[model samples]
Target chain A: MGIFYFVAFLSVFFALMTIFTKNPVHSVLYLVITFFTFTVHYILLNAQFLAVVNFIVYMGAIMVLFLFVLMLLNLNKDTEPMKSTLVKVMGAIAGMCLLATFLGAFRVLEGQNEYVTGNTDVGLVKNLGKVLFDEFLLPFELSSILLLTAMIGAILLAKKETKQG
Target chain B: MEGAFILEKLILVVVVFTVTLVIAMYSTLAERKIAGFMQDRYGPDRAGIFGILQPLCDGGKFFFKEEIIPAGAHKTLFILGPVIAIITACISSAVIPWGQDLVINGRTVSLQVADVNIGVLYVFGVIALGVYGIMLGGWASNNKFSLMGAIRAASQSISYEIGMGLSLIALLMVTETLQLGEIVAQQSGFVNWNIWVQPLGFLIFITCAFAECNRVPFDLPECETELVGGYHTEYSSMKLGLYMFSEYINMFVSSALMATLYFGGYNFPFMYDLGLSQNWITIIGVLVFFLKIFGFIFFFMWIRWTLPRFRYDQLMNLGWKILIPLAIANIVLTGVITLIKDTYFQ
Candidate 1:
């Protein structure tokens, strides 16, 4: 329990530091650290696959791309969107309210035992593939469509104008 | 959970880390030597006979050199850049299974630090994060060249990553497991190496590996004449050293990955044929693993000096127009073949 708490505390601290850091590059880098600590959390939870995926997609691909964008923009100045103390306090209050509401709602709910998974095969790669391809065929196909739209959107946005225009 | 187990894990981790670090360090020497020999010149003959101590000397130089944070650079980010790079590059090895588990004194010890079901994915994930090191270092350097280099790296890495992931899909389909150990286990005996079954995947894997490591032919990001030191343009001393060292380290990791994935990891010809003792078997396993790693490393260095880099437009075209589509086709072909084999051949 103590070990778990220690990891959780470190995770939260690093995450807060990531967002609070002034330099965008530093912030992105810290976010990488935060993602790593999350992997640690995932390890503690025995969700090895999630941890690895987190490392690959969030830390490796996404954050690096973010840092690249930050570099391209040359956003080294101290002027990028640092909220005032009053704004921070107000945001904190609103955040707490949202948290309280969510907890209160989940607490009051009486139908919570809807899904109990005593099965160990729940997270296996084989099981995941079966479920994804078989049971979720519609959504899976829909996602392909979504991806196709995104590709077309990107191409449309990036296409250069002709001289005749 | 006992002190003994903790100590054992510690010893294993330290041994693995040191071996990896040493290999990476020597890879730099090997790279220079290859380049020197290729150019018909001496590589390094000073600092211990035949420059054996060259790596150590280079480390000393990096340590002694002044740590210069350029004026107008983000001070904190400037420092954080290399630290992130080195640490990320180092720790990504955690999930890699060095060899099979060894049992001693009634304790069953696994070769890996973490035997998560998603071992392969974890490797991918950790490597993905590695790009940030280069990205951050370049951005924080506050140089146009650095920024340009960073953009090139980011684009190149992400572009190649699609092919990398796609190439692995065939392997995943074949093995039906994401654990690196299980992957190796499935390929235990001879004739089962993935290189044979998934030849196209293997080719794609090798090409993507080269791109992922930013080596020659895919090294548009840091082509010297073009980008002027690329991402590390403004870096000096140890900061620059870290960027360069991390590349070699990344190369080492990728080499280990290639060995582990395509080759039968640590299962050389005739290891069990001798029927050696446990400790001796472990030693042989580790040695064989290193031999394979060094072989791959030598290949990496040989190619680095041998091949010229691809043009930027050509590199992008290769990734998107060619590799991604081929990777998808490979996956489809692999799936169909597997289905056919299972349905009829089996």
Candidate 2:
């Protein structure tokens, strides 16, 4: 539980640092760290497959793409335009309101029976594969088809644009 | 009793760590010696007999050399780059089954560090993370050449990783498991090895592995004639040494992985008939595993010296157009074969 809290703290801290950092590259690096901490949380929950997938997909591939774009754009603090104080104040207020909404939702759940947790094997690859294939097969297949279509569309659009240029 | 168990695990970890370092160190020497021999010349025999102590000399040279950080470089990320590189390289060994279990005092101790169920995926994850070290180092160098090299490396790795994963999928289809130890156990005899069954898959896998390691002829990222030392151009002293060392370590780990995945790992023919004790059998298995890994390492070095470096566009084309499609075809072939076998033979 202590390790959980420490990891949670790190996740939140790095998430904030992702936004607060002046350099875009540093911000991306911080975001990667945030994702890494979340991976740790997944491991703690015994979802080793999910943890490894999260590490590979998000922190590895996605973040590398993010860093690639950031490096190419060459964005720095000096080039960043400043926001108005009014905008900052309004953003803070909006954030606080969202936090209040989340807290209220949790408060409503506090009086109910505590969350049930067992069957740790559910997170294992074999069990997860069985559930995904047996129960959620249709939805899984449908989602994969959707992703494939999106990928093809993206490729076609990019190719057309390049040819015209 | 738990304390003893933990102590055993700790000792295994330490041993694995030291062995990886020693192998990586010698790999450099072997690479040089082999390269020289191939070119009809004597290699570094100055440091010790057969230049065995060359790695030590290299280590001392790195330590005594002056460290440099470019004025415009990001100080923190610059240092973090090599640290990330070496850490990712070292951690990859955790999932590899070094040998069969050693039985002592009625306790069976596995040679691997962590027998994670998703062993293959863990290796993939660590290899994928390896790009960060090169990318970060290159970007932080604040040099155009370094940035270009980093981009090349990142793109090349990402592209080849697709082919590598696809090739592995065919093997996984055959084995029906992701655990490294389980995969090894399944291939107990010479004929049971996955290589004979999925030869095309092995070819594609080994090709992608070469590209993923940024080795020749796929080493476009650090093409010395073009990139001026590539990502490590601005690096000096031990930071540079760490990056170089990490590459060799990555090679060692990848060789071990290839051996484990396709070459039957620590298995030998008719070992049970020899009438050896379990511990002795396991010891022989470990030795055989090392022999396979060393063979693969030597293969890597041989190809490095023999093949000419790929042109950047040629590398990309081979990765995406050739290797990826070949891997996908291997998967289809494996599936068809498996279906036919199940329907007719069973």
Candidate 3:
């Protein structure tokens, strides 16, 4: 439990740092660290499969893509256009609104902390697979279709740009 | 009792750590020696008997060498890069089942450090993290060449990983378990090895493994004639050594994984016929596991010296167009065959 709090604090710290970092590359690295802390949280929750998957998919693959593009663009602090005070103030106002919304939603669910459990094998691969294949098969298959469509769309867009250029 | 258990685990961890470092260190010497022998010359026979002490000399040199960070480089990331590389490399050995089990003082101890149910997934996750080391090093160098090399490495590793994971799916279908120890137990004898059942998957796996390890024919990221040491171009001293060391360690771990997944890890034929005691059997099993690992390492070196590096486009095409489809087909075929056997033959 103590370890969990430590990791949680680090995750939130890194999450904030990701946004506030001056360098884009450093921001991406901090985001990767944030994802790693989330992975640690998953392990603590006894969802080892999800933890590993989160590490592989988020920290490993997606963050590499993020870093790759950031590096390729070669954006530095010097080249970054300064935002006006009005724009910064509006951004903070919008962030505050989102935080208030989240707090209100949590407040509505605050009294529903009753621990009810059965078939506690939720995170194990075998149980997850059974649940997905048996109960949520339609949604699972639809999600795959959505991913496939997105992939094809990306390829087509890339190919068309290459041909035009 | 708990203290004893903790002590045992500590000893095992230390032993595994030492063994991994020793193997990686020697692999550098062996790679050079093999390369030299292929070119008809003696390789590093100056230090000690047949250059046995060459790794020590190399380590000493790295320690004494002047460390440099480029003027415009990201200092924090430059240091973090190699540290990430070596840490990821070392942590990967945790899931591998080095041997069956050892009995000491009337207690049985598993050879593996962690026997997590999702062993294969853990290995995959570690392999995936490996790209960051190269990518960060290259990007932090603030050099265009280094950046390009890192980009190449990231794409290459990501591309190959797809095929590798796809090939592994077929093996998983056959074994029906993700635990490395369970997979080995299933292949108790020579005849029961997954290689016989899924030869095509093994072929795809080995090809992807070559790409994953950044060996010849797939080493475009760091090809000397092209990117000038690739991601490590701006690195010097022990930082550079760490990158190189991590590569060798990656090779060692990958070889051990391949031996475990496909080649019946720590299993020997006719062990029961020999009627050896359980302890002796385990000892032999551990020795056999090392033998298999060494065999795969030698194979890696042999191919490195023999094959020419693939053109970048050709490498990408092979990874995506050829290997991925082949692995998918292998998985489908395995599924169909398993279905037929269960429905008709059974």
Top candidate on DockQ is 3
Error of 3 at A14 (Å): 1.0
Rank all candidate structures by their TM-score, best first, as comma-separated numbers.
3, 2, 1
**By DockQ thresholds, what CAPRI class is model 1?**
medium
Q: What is the lDDT of residue B132 in candidate 1?
A: 70
Model 2 Cα lDDT, one tens digit per residue, B176-258: 98999999999996889989998998998899899888888988778899999998999999999999999999999999999
What is the CAPRI rating of model 3's predicted complex? Answer: medium
Which pairs of residues clash in candidate 1, taking residues 3 or more apart in a chain or in different chains? A52-B122, A55-B125, A56-B125, A59-B129, A60-B128, A60-B129
- lDDT (Cα atoms) of all candidates against the true structure: 0.81, 0.92, 0.91
Candidate 1 per-residue C-alpha lDDT over A56-165 given as tens digits, one digit per residue, 9 for 90 to 100: 77877777778767766767566566679999899999999999999998777746532222444544566656777998889999999999999999998899976654
Please rank every candidate by lDDT, starting with the best.
Answer: 2, 3, 1
Per-model TM-score on C-alpha atoms: 0.87, 0.94, 0.95
Candidate with best lDDT? 2
Expressed as tens digits, the lDDT of each residue in B86-143 for candidate 1 is 8878887887778877877767787877766787887777677667777777777888
- Chain B, per-candidate TM-score: 0.96, 0.99, 0.99
In model 2, what are the clashing residue pairs, if there are any? none
